[model samples]
Target: MKVFVLGTGGWGIALAMLLHHNGHAVTSWTFFQEECDLLHRERANEKLLPGVRIPEGITVTTDMSGAAEADLVVMAVPSFAVASTAEQLSRIVPAGTVIVNVGKGLDSQHGYCRFSETIDRAMGGRNPVVALTGPTHAEEVARGVPTAIVAASASRAAAELTQAAFMNDTFFRVYTSSDLVGCELGGAFKNIIALGAGISDGLGLGDNSKAAFMTRGLTEIARLGVTLGAKQETFAGLSGVGDLIVTCCSMHSRNRRAGILIGQGKTAQEAMQEVGATVEGYYATEAGYRLAQQQGVSMPITEAMYEVLYNGLSAKEAIRMLLGRPRRGEHEEVWFH
Candidate 1:
């Protein structure tokens, strides 16, 4: 496969390496000419994935035209950049080229449009959009650590093509799904819960507290996801519970790290500055909160996270408020009869 990855961020570079290693002719693009020159000269993205060598087979470039004719074009930009990148790709890539989006946040500026919808709108519905997401992190994937991810699309052919392009027996595994909505929601909303889990860690809370936080957090995610037309079972799959577990516990999760900083007395903006990366959870929190409100779903954890992120509420106070809610059956509203 001739694969072009749009965006040279950590995730983008990692996928470039993965595809190149998988025997595909891979080319990756960066936004700036300087970044293109740096990666081409150094052969490594030291700032993002230190010590990982770029394969000799992968081509690094600054021009979108370099990827215009590839068999698969992976959109690995941050969520905020999805629409613009799609718009850019629409002019370059031909109408039938498959675009696989690895971004996981809702479009906060456009009624929280899913990445696929953003791509569809931006590309004028010319391409098939497949969403590839799960618990796999760039850090681990770059190191060839064992990981599994899901490839979801309304088109079965697109999903299988993505699976065939990236799946490897040793370190990478891929599954297919038709529920792009569920997969996108699962991947996006987990970051909010991971932030709350980090707050728990920063408060010196034990594993018990973190466990409760994650489980209940999934409930909040599922509630809103179902309201928005996602399959409930998707929340129990790799992009859901699997992604949630890793984000909450892994040292590599920017959202959790940012939350820890906020829990330790830094404001949301301050934490993000210190993290020095795009913390998708910060933006997702606001988007998810608004979506829940618009859909008449109760997402208490998301509400708490929104307060912490925007309303200047302390983490301790947020936790207190969360626990202070009236008791209800644990299974209430979880299972649809």
Candidate 2:
């Protein structure tokens, strides 16, 4: 299969390497000539993905035209860039091309819609959009570490096709799901929770506080997801709780790192600048807060996140707000006889 990856970020380059290893001809597209030149000249993205070498078999370029010939097109750009990239590909890639979106975040520009919806609308519904997401991180996946992910789409054929293209028994594993909404929501909302976890760590909170924050944060995520028509079971799967755990706990998660800085007294903007990478949780927090309000869902953690990230509330105050909320049942649905 000929695969075209539509970004040069760490995740994009990592997937390109994985596909090339799977015996597919891979081409990576970037918007900037300088990044293209760097990848072409060095065969490695040392800054974003340190120590991982890009094989010679993969072609790197700034041209979007190469995507026209791809059997599979991976939307590896950041969530903010997905719409623009999809619009660009609409003029290039043929109809029915299977688009695999590896980025995990909602479309803030389109009512916080899933990336698949954003892509589908951009392409005039000409292509099948599959969200390939989970707990897997670029740094780990690029190094060929054991990683499992999901390929979700409304169309089972598209999901299965993506599964076949990326799955292997060794280090990379892929699962298929028909619940695209659940999968995408899980992947996107978890980043906000990860920010809270990092903030807890930065505040020198112990394991008990972090664990409670993660648990309640997940409840908030699930409440919104179910309100938006996603399956309740999906939150328990790899894309939901699974992705949440890894993102909150791992050093490679930019969202958590940024939250740590914010918790340590830096503002959200300051933390993002210091992190020097796209901390997706920042954007997600804004979108999630809006979505929760529009849907009338109770997402206290997300609301607190919004206060810290946008409303000028301090991180410590946000934590205090979360802790001071009126006590409630662990499971809202549970009843005592």
Candidate 3:
């Protein structure tokens, strides 16, 4: 298979290595000439996925034309860059090429459209789009650590093809799903909750509070997901609760780290600058809040996060505001059929 990956960030580099190892002809893209030159010369993406050597077979470049004849094009850029990358790919990629997005987050610029929809719209539906997401982290995956993820698409064939191309027995596992909406939502919303969890950790809150926060956060995620036409059951799978638990608890989570800084007397700006990485949760918090409002879904946790991240509301005040909300039934099933 000829696979071209856009974005030479950690996730992109990691997947490019995986594909190269799997005997595919792989090419990867970087936005800047300096980064592209460094990858080609050094055969390593030291800035992001350090210690993992880029395979000699992989070609890294800054040219979008590298995607023209590829059988598959993977969009591994940050969520914010998905639209632009998709637009670029649409112009270069061959007709009927499968494009899989491993980027996780809602498209804030497009009314929180999932990556599948965003990519499809960007390409005018000329290509099939699949979203691959789960608890997998680039740092771990780059080192060949064991990880499992789902490939979701409205087109089941596209999902199955992605599954075949990426799955490996020892270190990587791929599951297929038709619930693209659920998978994308799960991947995006958990980041917001992860930020909240990080704030809890920074505030000296113990396991009990964080655990409760995670549980309710899952509920809020499911509610919003269902409201947006996702299967409620998908929230229990790898992309939802699984991803949430890992992101909220793991040290590898940039979102959680940023949230911790914010909780510990740092402004959001200060926290973000300190992290020095793309905190998808920070962006997700705002997009999720607006989506909640537009959809009329009650996402208190997401709302609280939005306040803390954007509206000058302190984390403590947001917590207090949430605790003061009127009580409701704990088990109202929100099934999306």
lDDT-better candidate, 2 vs 3? 2
TM of each candidate vs. truth: 0.97, 0.98, 0.96
Where model 2 places Cα greater than 4 Å from the true spot, the runs are 333-337
Q: Flag the better candidate by TM-score, 2 or 3.
A: 2
Worst 10 residues of 1 by lDDT: 328-337
Candidate 2 clashes: the total is 0
Judged by lDDT against the true structure, how good is candidate 2? Answer: 0.91
Model 3: per-residue Cα lDDT at residue 50:
70
Give Cα distance to truth, residue 154, candidate 2, Å.
0.4
Model 3: lDDT to the true structure? 0.90
Predicted candidate 3 versus true structure: per-residue lDDT over 189-267, tens digit per residue: 8999999999999999899989989999999889989988999999999999999989999988999999899889898
Residues 1-337 of candidate 2 have per-residue lDDT tens digits of 9999999899999999999989999999999999999988999988998899999999999898988999999999977799999998999999999999999998988888999999999899989999999998889889999999999999899999999999988899999998899999999989999998998898998999999999888888989999998999999999999999999999999999998998898888999999998889999999899998898898989999999899889878888888898987778676669
| Worst ten in a row by lDDT for model 2 | 327-336
> Against the unseen true structure, what C-alpha lDDT does each candidate score?
0.92, 0.91, 0.90
